[model samples]
Target: MQTINLLLAGFQSAFELAAFITVVVGLLVGVIAGALPGISFVNAMAMALPFTYAMGATQAMLFLGGIYVGGVFGGSISAIMINVPGTPASLPSTWDGYAMTRKGQVKRALTIAVTASATGGLVSALMLTFLSAPFASFAMRFSQPEFFAATVLGLVSVIAIAKDKPIITLISLLIGMAIGTVGVDPLYGQARFSFGIPEVESGIRFVVVMIGLFAIGEVVDLVASNRDLRPKKTDGKPERVRLRDILAVKGAILRGTGIGCMIGVIPGAGATPGAVIAYGVEKQINPRGAEFGTGVEAGLAAPEAAKNATTGAAMVPLLTLGIPGSAATAIMLAAMMLQGVNPGPLLFIMDPSMVYTIFAAMIIANVLMIGAGFGVAQMFSTLMRTPPAILAAFIVVLSLIGAYGVRNNIFDVYVCLVFGVLGWAMKRVGFPSAPLVLGVILGPLAERYFLTAVANSRQDYSVFFTRPISATILFIAFVFVLWSLWPTLKSRIGRQPA
Candidate 1:
């Protein structure tokens, strides 16, 4: 009953002119930003941060939440249309979605992507609405050790994403962790790898690294390959999707949503891993598994659902424990802090209206995304008529500006360009960059929690395993690593001469 009342109040608050307008504007910005290569929704959120200062706390949450919901779905637009993912989570879309586009079934591919995305996001938003309070209560019992264990779980989950290529993934992850260690020590406050550069002491921002790694490399590929951006026509008629088409993939959407929600609740896991893991799972179980990369409908539907599903689920830890689940949520954490609001159990008790309003806004955003997504897709499809060189040039300039905007520092831009070159090189070699980005985003948080946990236990290493919750989480992570590696080990053993 109380939950019902709160929801009613939330709707009342969210429907007000200012709040409604903010959500609509933010949703549009997010969709446009996410549909454009190199301007990820995270970048859009970061750029929108300063503007949030002019709004009230609840309005600001509504605005950012709207963007969060819309942006996750928007990336699939470019992924399906251009063979280039607008965001890291959209990587799986290119595998099958672009294949569909090549066959001139672009409209059908997009319809599957959008419908699955909206379904996943809607379910996730509802979960956020009802589950966060109880989750917050559970989180109240967490200590330093528990937090560290959760972070470790998130870190190891990346292995599931790598499957048989763990070696390269580990290398990429280690490189990111090393980069994360460059700044001042979390405990001692003494610089480790600054080398006397003042800006280095403050640490490299993940936002700059993300923009450079994802944006610049993609644009360079566009310019180098002179890729065609125009969609292919199929007998001068557009493919139409019907309700029956969506019903055919209901199971895939459900599975993807489940995976996404589970992954997203982890303190450091985010949409990239969620989407990748879902694709892997779908490939394992679907009857068309062998034809996964050949534009299977399940292939396009599952990851699209998973990526958008993570949007609302990622908000769980952020709202409950004040822990950011991904780089995007980290930006939201910064936004809240800037507004003199701290999320956690206290926020729920003290500002139920704000919490529920944000929930309502998430629901509203996902509901509205169907229209917003198609509108942006239509606009971008038309814009694809532009020359590839001109689009690439614009992407490059916008990416650089996003990098520089991190702290309004030119040094960050230099770092971004350097990483951009490295990212391009990595891509040419077929190396996975997603794991590296994940490590950069999560490594510092893991370090902070690990150090704090050890200190709290008076340097006792057993503290992580002595606690039941912490031990269980670590055990699960250990089992996950073994489970992921067993297939390769079994295959290798079977290949040995008998």
Candidate 2:
């Protein structure tokens, strides 16, 4: 009853004209920014940080919360339609969502994606409203060792996507980890593999690398294949969403939401890992696991749901314990500090109204995201109607701009071009690049966490196994790896002569 009253009060405050408008505007900006390659929602939030100064505390949180919800889903727009993930979390979407686009089911793909995303985010928001306190306690239990174990789980889970090519996938992932190591040593603060170049010492930005690998390689493929992206005519009838289609993937959505909520509360494990882990889990469980990359609806829906579901759950640590779980939440923390608000258990008692109001805004944003997603998706899909050369040119220009904008350095542009060529070449040879990308994304986090855990534990290697949580997470990763590789092992056994 108390929770209900607090949430009701929250809804009342969020519905006020100023707050509502702020949310709507933020939602639109986030969706557009996320759909554009190179300009992620994190950058959008950073750019919008100045504008929040003009608004009251609650309104400011409302605006950024709306963007947080919308941006998580926005990346899927490009991933599904163009095979370029606007964010790392959307990489799994490209495997299945883009496959659907290739099969001329863009409308169906978008409908499923938006529906799953809204459902996941809505559930996450509700959980945030009611379970914040208990979940905060759970999140607090995670230390550096456990965090390192979670990162290892994320890295090992990539095996599910290897498709019987585990050796090659492992090699690709290792190469990515190598790339991630080029900047500075996390523990020593010394640069390695920079060859004394200033830009190399600054490290390669993953966003620039991501844009080059997916966007540039995709445009090259588009120009080379001469594939037409215009909507296909099907006896003068447009493909529509079926009730059965959503029903078919209901299990995936629920599972993804649960996984996302669990992962989000872990400080360093953000939406990217949540989405990828969801995809890997769905592949292992779904009956059509072998057909994951061929446009399976469950494949697309699970990750879409998982990524957006992380939005509200990601905020729990920030709101309850004054800990910023991810970069996005860190910005929110800055906004709160700028407003003279300190978030902690005391904030709930002292400023319950503001806290609950932000909760209400998250719910509203997720609900509103459905309409925003379709509106933006419709606009992006029209780009498919353009000639291949023009479309390719547009993608390349956007890719280049995104690369250069990473740090406003010409050297980053050169790195992106080098990666672009490598991506295209890898694509030509049918080598998996996603694992390499994952390696780059998680390797640094794993290294930082592992080093901190070890250093803090007096260089004790047994610290991981000594802790219950860390040991449990590492054990799970081990089981997951064996489970993922079981099919190949069984297949080889079947082919052996007696």
Candidate 3:
């Protein structure tokens, strides 16, 4: 009953004209930024930070939350239409989404993507509204050991994505971890593998690497192949999505939303892992598992659902414990701190209105994203009508700019170009780059938590296994790895014919 009253009050605040307009504007900004390859929504939020200084605390949260919800789903626009992922989480979309585009079903693909994304995000926002207090209380009991175990689970989840080529996947993951180790040590702060370069000592930013690995290589492929970018008209009419289409993938959306909400609450496990894991899981369970990369509807729906679902779930740790679960949330944290507001349990108690209003904004944002997503996707699809050379050139230029904008450093731009060439080479060999990107994102987190846990336990290695939560999660990870490999193992045994 108290929750109901608080939510009602939240609706009142969020519905105010100024607050509502801010949400709409932020959502538009997020959609555009996310739809553009290399310019992630996190960058948009960072750019929007200075603008928030002029607003009230509640308004600031509302604005940022709107962006958080919309931006997560916005990346699918490019992924579905252009074969380029605007964000790391959108990588899964390239598997089946672009395949759909190639078959001239771009409208159908975007419809499924946006619908699933909105549904998943809406449910997650509700979860955030109602479950945050209890979840925050539970999270408070987590120590470094628990965090390390959770990070390990996220790392091992990549196995699910590589059932057929586990060996190659592991190799790629290890190489990325090696790259992650190139700069200052997370624990001791001692620089390693810097080779005396001032910029190298500071470490490589994943955003720069992500832009290069995804955007530049894709542009090169477009230019080299001279692929047409225009969406084929369906009998001279726009393709209309039906209710039955959404109903067809309801199960995938539910499963993806569940996985995303669970993973998003775990600090350091962000939307990218959530989306990838959802795709892997969906591939395993769907009837058309073998057809996943061949433009299956469920394949397109699951990752889109999972990626957007993380938006609200990722805020649980941020608002309740003052821990940012993802890069975007980290910017929101900065925004809050800039406003002299410290987020935590105490903030909830003292500023229930602000907290609840932000929750309301997230709910509204997800609901509004369906329309915003369609508008931005339509605009981008129109841009696809331009000549291939012009479009590819723009992608490359924007990618370079995005890389340089990461820290306003020229070295990142150079690093991006190098990785671009490397990414193209890897693609030519059919090597998976997703696992490598995952390793780079999660490896450092695992290292930091493991080192901290060991130090806290007086260098005791058994600390992870001894803790109940950590042990349980690790056991789950073990089960996931076995499950992922079971199909391959069965196939090999069947071929042997004992």
Candidate 4:
């Protein structure tokens, strides 16, 4: 009943012409920014944040949120067409997506990507609007122990997702945590790891790190591969998705949406994780799963569906409990705070109207995203046939421009160069690139939240266990960690006879 009222109220409210226009601009900008390699949603939002200072709070939020949603699917464009995922969330998409591209079905992949994103996002947003309020009321009961446990659980769950080995992911996370120490301490003003460099005192900016790791690193990978033409097995012209294709893979959509929404509802499991797990789970459950890596529709549908769904589910914590599930949501939180909107229990009571505005804008942005995604995908799809020289040159220019656009700093460009080289080196040595980027993004949040929990705990170790909700969340995190490690643990204990 409450949800219906909110929905109806949201629809009746008149969005200012300018505010609605901001959403349109944001959707367009997001699609372009996302389609570009190395310019993930974070940079897109940060890049556009300053421009919003002159706009009204609602408009600015809608614009930025639109970008945030649109950008994730954007990465799949290059991931499918060029064998390069434009964003981290698109990584799982790369396996089947790139395979489909090789078979000259890049358009098919793009269509599924865009559609799944819309479906997942809509489901998640609907969940957020209907369920966040109750969750917010529940979250207010959190104490120091519960909060601390929740933090531990979040960090552990991420590490647990490392299927081959959890230790490697944990080590990567620790390294990220260590790098996070370079900035000023939150509780104390003293510098921790400046290493005699003043710029290090503020620590490395997340935007700088992301650009270097994702964008520049990808450049190194692309150049090193140096392959000009993709192998063609299907008709040379790309396949446009028929409604039949969607119907055939209906199960993938449902499963991915369920998985994404579930993971997204949690405080730390972001869209990427949802996508990864959904991809893995989909392949495992399907009878033809073994053929997934060999290239199939289900493979493409799983991650695409989950990643889009996650964008919505991530909002559940952010709007309801004043906690953000993913880095993008965290940024959304920051953006909202900047605009003078505090998201908590009070938010629902104080401005039901604004809540409705956000709800309306999300649904509308999604509708716009479909049109925008297809338009951009087609334009890029045409360019996909361009000469390799031209393609590389375009990527290089976009990379450099995106790097410089953040702060207009030459140093960031230098950092991009250094990381580009580092990425190439790592690829040569066969280290997985995805985990490193994940560590870098999630590291600071894990550390900051943990530290906050500890400082607030004030030596009360029992606080973590005493609180039922926190304890339960922590238990789940531990379960996931143990589950991930069990096979390895058993193998270590008993070696098979050769």
lDDT of each: 0.82, 0.90, 0.86, 0.72
RMSD of each: 3.8, 1.1, 1.9, 4.2
Best by TM-score: 2
Q: Which residue window of length 10 is worst by lDDT in model 2?
A: 227-236
Tens digits of per-residue lDDT for model 4, 155-184 = 554443454646666676576556656678
- Against the hidden reference, what TM-scores do the models get? 0.83, 0.98, 0.95, 0.80
Lowest summed-lDDT stretch of 10 residues in model 3?
A: 227-236
Q: Candidate 3 at residue 459, lDDT?
A: 91
How would the candidate models be sorted by TM-score, starting from the highest?
A: 2, 3, 1, 4
Please count the clashing residue pairs in each candidate, in the order shown. 0, 0, 0, 2
In terms of lDDT, the best-performing candidate is 2
For residues 401-428, what per-residue lDDT tens digits would candidate 3 score against the true structure? 8888878999999999988888888888
How does residue 210 of candidate 3 score in lDDT?
Answer: 74
**Whole-structure CA lDDT of model 3:** 0.86
Off by over 4 Å in 2: 229-236
Model 1 accuracy (lDDT, Cα): 0.82
Off by over 4 Å in 3: 231-238
Candidate 1, which segments miss by more than 4 Å at Cα? 16-18, 36-58, 79-105, 195-199, 229-236, 263-303, 314-355
Error of 1 at 204 (Å): 3.8
* Per-residue lDDT over 179-287 for candidate 2, one digit per residue giving the tens place of the 0 to 100 score: 9988889899999999988889988888888888898877777667776645454456787889998999999999999999989888868999999999999999999
